[model samples]
Target: MTSVKDFRVEEEPTATDLGRGRFVFSDRYSVFDWGEMPDHIPNKGASLCLMGAYNFELLDVNHVPTHYVGVVEDGEVKDLGECESPPTEMAIELTQVPDLPHEDGEYDYGAYHEVAGENYLIPLEIVFRNTVPVGSSLRKRGEPADYGLDTEEWPEEAVDLPEPVVEFSTKYEEQDRYLDRDEADDIAGVVDLDQLEELALAVNHILTDHAARAGFAHEDGKIECLYHDGTVKVADVVGTFDENRFSYDGQQVSKEVVRQYYKRVQPEWVDAVAAAKQEAIETGEPNWREQCEIEPKHLPDEIVDALSDLYCAGTNAYVDYDWFDAPSIEDAVAAARDLN
Candidate 1:
């Protein structure tokens, strides 16, 4: 099970084939690599499932390959448009996720690829960025001119990029770290690095166009893929708020709202989490969470309510469907902004 979803394998895949499974999305959320937080956002699971299904269908229409099959309702798999209500479980084609071996403070990708033949999940996350927001890691890794900004320094607020930037990062590591093209290609195993980047850029463009039509800014997001039979297909959920950062009228319309809320109300815990990760890297301990002393506090009721509305409203707007009786996106963003 993942931090926010329960994975159930109904049919196992052969060495050369795919399997069938279902992802039961949950209301649980995670931040700072913490497994699970103390509060549950109402209808969050359904919202994610709906948005994910919608985007998968959109990708299929655009000729992008994915692992999505359908959404589950009443023990039957059906198309998202056929679902009478929002579904919490998504039916998917399963790909092998081999255990990434970490030893002596180093990950052994050679060992990982030895067992993960073809038909396995790629061990890298392809991230695409159209804008660099405040507190973005890009600010630390690059200068403003690097992303085509005219100024010598990054602006205090979010700034649009002249073109989308695609990056790669470790997916199965204890702590994710950005990778250069050489390292990324090595980790990709059988998938061609250039093809992977092309796929990611396609996804980014599609998501950006959809978000634009929905009146939201698709700032950045990451996608994981499965390599099988000399082909790479998008795996796991995509285009959801959890996987992407989006904004409406300069206000967050994604999980960033909740992340910022924690930063505001639980700075100590957040700092402790960061410290623990750094300590883990220095000490070569794999489980950095154990070193974290402070735990996340439960979110306030008002904040939870606001986040629920924000997620639901944003989903409705993006999909152009009233799946939930949610308030207008403007009202939801206003409510969440007021909490800050």
Candidate 2:
């Protein structure tokens, strides 16, 4: 029966920064311009905090210098006398790196490169994917010959890639612009290119292995690195359903739950969402006309149970070969009849 008390605080945990360095991330959820919608995903905050702490500990064990100290459990407040466990969600000690400048809500890397320089949180989100789904950029590339690069044959079907594909994105970029190795290097100047590549590979392997253990293939994951000084460690939550696509026995879930929801059920308004997003890109105005549409339609009680069970199953399924955590995609369709 664990619960967090303080839900929103922009900065570190204590009034005075503990030399040890403690920071607590916000549990606030947002999509597009919409923040804090009508519905709440039960236990999502707890799970996210727990997952982040778990990865930090894992990286610490592997000698990675991340901004992680420990979990701020159910009762811990600013420490006075040392008790066994503290209150609230996980709060970890992290280096106080200065955040970069942004004007008109745009990342000004020119300023970032000056002040943050080496200490700047690498202004990028790196993604690695292992499968080509329906609307993937690769799928959009289509099967036309000599359209662009002389890429190898790409199957129309959702095919598992032979190797994981890595792409870099500017931090929090909604339309995720792809970056070449040279482009990535140009942005993260202090970042060692060879090391970055190796790190990405290592992260993929680690996540893939553990996700396999968790009954989800690591199909792909992302990591953000901030170079304080010497060491490079994985930042953000690693190998979580939220961070990566998790399929239960080939059933689509993860962000696809939201993605497909936008694409399928409300195709009319959802298309508007996409079109609005595209307009933002073309005009440099992020004015998504549709924000809180219909208060985020809720799932049936049975579907909620199914989703919980899916997560519970993923929690256990990766332990073995049987992908028991998720209902077969066909079976799930039958259950949808219970919903509106």
Question: Candidate 1 residues 61-171, lDDT tens each?
Answer: 999999999999999999999999999999999988788888888899998888889889999999999998889998999899878889997888889999999999999
Query: What lDDT is obtained when candidate 1 is compared to the true structure?
Result: 0.92
lDDT of 2 by residue, 1-340 (tens): 1122233333542322422333343333334334453344544454454455555555566665665546654444332113242122545433334555545746555655666544446777778777767667756544624233245676556667666766787774444566777877877767786776667777777667666665455566787776656566565456655677767556654545544544556666556656676776776654445432444454455555554444434433433322233554445433433332
The most accurate candidate by TM-score is 1
Model 2: ten consecutive residues of lowest lDDT:
1-10
- Candidate 2, residue 139: how far the Cα is off, in Å: 3.3
Off by over 4 Å in 2: 1-35, 75-88, 95-107, 141-153, 172-175, 287-301, 316-340
Error of 1 at 165 (Å): 0.6
